[model samples]
Target: MSGTSSQGEGSPGGASADSVRRRRVPRAERERQIVDVAVEVFAKRGYHATSVDEIAELAGISKPMVYLYLDSKEGLFLACLHREANRLVVAFQGAAKAVAPSPELRLHAGLLAFFGFVAEHRAGWVVLHRQAAELTEAIAGAAAEARRAVMAEVADLVRAGIAESGPASRLSAEDADFVAHALVGAADSLTDWMARHPGRTPEDVTLRLMNMVWVGMGGVLAGRTWSLEDPGDAPH
Candidate 1:
């Protein structure tokens, strides 16, 4: 009788564990899982080459379910772009805010965070950097919006730096915007360079950029002007 009771108890315990394993995941979680898989697929294959069927197989769901969650292939790609862009912005803002209010330090922290994101989330970065363009108007617009968001943040930092330099500083809001655009453009180009030179770290890149841009800006604020005639007067 004791043997039979022990067998009966073990059967129910096994059944209960199976039930827990088969429990339905929440809808939001399931959608996230799909998007996560889609990011990898899109990164590897690009938007045109990636297929919904493959994403579903990788995610362990039906293609219909992927459509049900994201509506269409375009929708899934858009979702990936939006999530990655927001994550990048959050990383930059969080890192910048954590440090002292000095604009130089803040910018360095933000650039380090940006490079770190690119290094760590290579797939997501590929989606944002390479795949976003050459798509539909909506897709291109989304990418542009993300760029504008980053540019705005950089502009604000540049503006603060200008203000801190006091009345003698020749830089205005317009100048700040220009500087921001230049910085963003340089960072974008440098990402490709970073990929080639894998040994160089994010810190190394950030320091190089700070020395290039910020140090020059300091000379400009100090009433030191650069001219073609006196090219030698430029900051080293």
Candidate 2:
């Protein structure tokens, strides 16, 4: 009797034994999966249009399961925004890591990364672009914080590039700020347009930007422009 009872208690078929071996998802993994599904949903249909139920369904889990993993729809959306913002920021910054590259190349790499991210993370980028209404205070705050960080980095690069180009005694602080904002604004607006058009490649967009701004870009560094000397009048 004792042997039989002990065997049954330790058996793999027993409820307690099954509980011990159950494969419950870790909090991080489950949250990641929830955010992944939420990104696609929010991207296709703006935040207001999305529901936790839809995300749950798309994620192959029950609604209650989604809540258990990520809380309410608002909470889930915020999570998605947070994840994507970090990813994009890292990508853009990483592209500028080449040491001692020219401002033009640095600018080129940064713009390429920006456009590449928007093209790659379609849902995540769309959520950031549109769905302003769906963003609660928390999400909006996080988004603003991320943008400020990127803007600061861009401004720093602009300052460095200008300095390298030469003595820009004319360019004011406000001028630098304006240029920084303009580049960001143009990239973001064009991102939306490029996404919709589908024909314009990322390189095409980056080249167009370089041509438009680079013609006068030297002014940013030297605060002035130098004219080509007449070869015949060689200042010997």
- The model with the greatest TM-score is 1
Q: For candidate 1, what is the lDDT? A: 0.88
Per-model lDDT: 0.88, 0.73
Residue-wise C-alpha lDDT for candidate 2, range 129-223, written one tens digit per residue? 67743468887877787777677767776776666765544665676678888888888789878968899988899899878776566643545
Error of 2 at 92 (Å): 0.6
Best by lDDT: 1
Residue 208 of model 2, lDDT score: 91
How many residue pairs in model 2 have overlapping backbones? 3
Q: Report the lDDT tens digits of candidate 1 across residue range 1-236.
A: 43332332223444554454455466788889988999999999999999999998888766777887799999999999999999999999999999998999999999999999999998999999998988999999999999899999999999999899887888889999999999999999899999999999999999999999999999887667788998998765
